[model samples]
Target chain A: MNEGETRKPIIVLVRPQLGENIGKAARAMLNFGLTEMRLVEPRDGWPNPSAGPAASGADIVLNRAQVYASTADAVADCAHVYATTVRKRGVTKPVVTPAEASSEIAAAQGRSAILFGPERSGLETEDVALARAILTVPINPEFGSLNLAQAVILCAYECSKHEGLVQPTQEDLLPPAPQEELDGLIAHLESMLEPKGYFRPEARAEATRRTLRGVLTKPAWNHLEVRTLRGVLSSLQREPRL
Target chain B: MNEGETRKPIIVLVRPQLGENIGKAARAMLNFGLTEMRLVEPRDGWPNPSAGPAASGADIVLNRAQVYASTADAVADCAHVYATTVRKRGVTKPVVTPAEASSEIAAAQGRSAILFGPERSGLETEDVALARAILTVPINPEFGSLNLAQAVILCAYECSKHEGLVQPTQEDLLPPAPQEELDGLIAHLESMLEPKGYFRPEARAEATRRTLRGVLTKPAWNHLEVRTLRGVLSSLQREPRL
Candidate 1:
């Protein structure tokens, strides 16, 4: 684990019944870079074969999991704990959404633990009693059922924001094709359309081409795509080959 | 379908090839109260039995699923069309996250459609060209593999927030326990822990109790949970009982 991983909150599953659910929870945690998993009395025991396939590729979480006899023991050393639940659960602690808790956890000193209850009923009162704060999201009351993995992913996703995890969409991508290439592509399309009557009346040819340009230029096609489209037009011409 | 469901954005799956993926997307949409689904040129044909089990219980989405010959035909009536994709795709349309786009779709004057591409490869240039804007999520650079359901859920969850969908945690919630009950509960635990030397040295006892009170009061437990805990305490004081 890296320094960030060491400082990240540990996920504690209290009496989780299904090995598949545990595996999915593991997958969700690792997706956001949280790998420390503490299992409190997993029903099928540790190293359940059913988990590996379901986890897809989140093996590190399952391998590094520490089993604790109880929820309190699992989070004994953590300075803060957030218990997730669907109901009010009669706990009088501060109610926080996952986003709110994630920010606080990022800024908090020492270790933190987030508790998830079982798949069927969720965290019991005793389990919730151990948390420093209740982390419950506003969800459909009639169908307040968020599968274990969904809940974990939501929390992990929020937590990931503060970790500065890499974002593909945020990268300095290759810029749109050079102006000349775009212009060439437009000219090529116009030439092809001119004989096909796509431009229609000679009086409206300019305006029609402008609208077509607006449609074609809207997509920030890269150089390669422009080349590919030019190639496609060439193939459609007389005897041209790919 | 509910009244608000009529105004909800239509989900358009363009050139989707897999049945299971379509099913899962349907499930995600329904989870967030979205049911309208339009498929453009599904390779496996419509009404694939394979979709039923994977959809879990989102039959309404399946039942109402519409098939279209092209993306344009699918979204022809939509005033706003947001296409989801990771790459820039040479599309110069304005980009927005699911949350930002959901808000706009909610307030827009006419019908809105959010298009998702296939599982193997996202929308083609022609497919994306039909959109008025782009809707994509910020994801990991190295592994931008978000399955169909996960992507659908992110956008649907955001839209649900704007739809004012019923929230279990927000409604019919029992009021927080009265201050007197909270105090009594604190005292009850203190009384129980006192003789066992739970507070430890007299010098730190006050601080310990203060911390305990903080933990107990943070959950915002309702009267029901307070009573249950008090019953638990009463039971602990006597013989063991269920």
Candidate 2:
């Protein structure tokens, strides 16, 4: 298996009633980089041509899907398995929310599977009994059922987040100027402002320098940012210093 | 100032051109911990009683807001100021998304300001010059104009998340071990596992140590858990070396 396969969660659709739902599930899985797919006794054609378009660019999942005669056969080798259900069946397995399930699944870091049952009737008692855990998404109790694909998408998002598959967030990526560049910019700025009444050379120059450095280093600077300030300082030399 | 006051961000309405926009800005600022407000050339009454209702629980921001004639005067005392604008001005200052800007502000461990431009004309060139950096919100270019309050809310949300005030929805707050303790655990784990052929005696142990450290450093285990594991190993050592 490739790195992506090992890192991602395997999505198993057990006894799905429609090809479109399967197709949409594939699309949702792909949105969050979950490509592994296992299908158990799909009511419609397993490789329906119509399912391809609905899958969008998630063709890889549809193309490489595994067909199974039973849910047991689908997840026989999975190290961890979670059954998605809305109603409680009084199963002995540990019940978990999607958030908790994702946390546990993230820690597993091995062959893990999430099983989604058919649209009309979810997994059979025997099918759910096979799971290590039962997972239920929190929704409005009055009308809580989510579409198969939407459920798949939410689960996938949670799993991807566990693996840190999301892009580098704006917060994580800082743009503070480096020490060397900042020192240069500060010196240049100080020299230019010294001639103006902005800094009193006797007592306030050091104080002003500290204040300037504090401002410059307040936020982390990125590569282009340091260079931009250097350019601005160089330009200021050609203009009025004060 | 209270501890909360010291921790929150400063919301600066720079050259804001509307009363309703200012009201909405106050509402957004209140959603997060940002209560400090500075208004620079507001088009309408800033301390206007009409702004009270719109501010919701953010009445303090409006009540204590300082009015100024120029953005420079408004932010003169602030250690770090970020000018917010929608369009890309020719000047090359470090531009950050609201999220990045917030984290930067939060980490400064001092007062940091987020500047917003007027709804009609936005900030002027000189106003942008007054700031150390620029904060930009990524929106759909076709319909880029955001409501003033919505923009403030976005900035506030980012700021709150960075300040450790808002709980993370996806991540577990794994308490970090002190440097000395973490180093000791790393050594203990290495010693315990080395005898089991986990690391070859002759090979460089740095890579193996790093991999093990990475796993242990994950949110899965706390410092106490690591200590317990060490006790388990010491007790197990009483048996056969393996």
Candidate 3:
């Protein structure tokens, strides 16, 4: 899909053993606005009461979650799937960070799922084989295991950041210069710098274009100031003697 | 190390179970420019033959690794230590993702290390007790085990990205305006707008400084041009026209 379409990640819980963990994962998913879920072999009943309270207000994930016996069934319609693991499991598939995976999932057609395994054993080695890439969390070597719900939260949070749900603290707040103004500024700069030999004969035009882009992209110049600068350049070009 | 000096992470493998995995971890660490490695209780001899072949030129990590017996001893001098795990080991510390962990680690003082565990049982519960915070990696629920070395690579990579290794994409590369030039510009701008009452007497100096800083920081004004503009302003300030 194009940038205009709203994108979300599908959280697939494979062989979840604890009802509370499932519920907690649901709650975490909702905390980041992720509701879609697919369940593969949940040991405890999906609608158990323990799950409801643990889910907080995330009943939506529980309500819409799809259940299956195998991971392949859950991700049948998914174009992209990532297997979560704390160990290598000897798979040769490409691995991606949660942020990268979210962007890929968002860009792909059809459904996508980030698969999770049981709390005790997690997914078997065979289960990870179905995924296109592996998702590994970076933790302390002394104690690297993470809670099931926590993993869900981590992925969900990364996906949310990638999807622009939260504004980054260091991002440039100013909007980029409009195309029309940028084009005019480029032309004006080229005309002025051309006579100054800023560009050699062979790569002159391309080099000039590159410099113009470099200057304008600095503060993302706005329309009025850009026009004023262009006017100054035009005047200079006309009155070469001055 | 203080905040400024703690931009990079010290990759630590605590009680690493396998030699090949250590090499693989080193390889991953190299991909992201992380060279430091601290080993806590390696099951196999470090700099093992198997590890070198597996490292694939991440020999820097292997060469620089410092080995210790206990996890606590390994990170004794570290101001911050994070344990990696797929499940919580009953530690009562804040849980943070590698991204968040890196930011905090970057701001912390003294050396830091992220601990990983042995292959079979992962990090011991006691080992996790020493960490100031717990790091959680987001993975697929169904396939949650990560290889020991892969874990090292992922965390190191994320930490490196925030430490200024990845330059900002903005194109302006002009030498920054000097402090004196910037000071002059601030003085000039304040005088230029003074007649219009842009800055009142009480807040004039502070407001002028802030505005100048904001504008100059945006485009990273050049030293020569800023002085020229300031010179023009000085002439205008001397005009004495109401």
lDDT tens readout by residue for model 1, A54-151: 78788878999999998867876665678998767544466787778888777655567899998888887667755656897666544444678877
TM-score of each: 0.67, 0.46, 0.41
Task: Estimate, for each residue in B39-106, the C-alpha lDDT of model 3 and write its tens digit.
Answer: 88787766578888877676767888889878888888788889888776566788887788888877
lDDT of 2: 0.66
Q: What are the candidates' C-alpha RMSDs?
A: 28.1, 21.4, 17.6
Candidate order (TM-score)? 1, 2, 3
Off by over 4 Å in 2: A1-9, A31-33, A76-79, A86-89, A97-111, A120-126, A138-146, A157-180, A200-207, A220-224, A237-242, B1-242
lDDT of 1: 0.74
DockQ for every model comes to 0.03, 0.02, 0.04
Candidate 1 residues B1-242, lDDT tens each? 55576568999998888898888888778777787999999989998888888787887889989999999999999999999997777779999988789899888888899999988889988888888899977665544446677778778777887877644343444677799998988788667666656566789888777766655665466776677556544544443222
In the range A51-165, model 3's lDDT, one tens digit per residue, is 8877766787788888887876777555456888876654444556666677666555445678898998888765675565678765433334456876787677667555544
Instruction: Judge the docking of candidate 1 as incorrect, acceptable, medium or high.
Output: incorrect
Docking quality (DockQ) of candidate 3? 0.04
Error of 1 at A192 (Å): 91
Off by over 4 Å in 3: A1-242, B1-6, B168-242
- Rank by lDDT, highest first: 1, 2, 3
- lDDT per prediction? 0.74, 0.66, 0.66
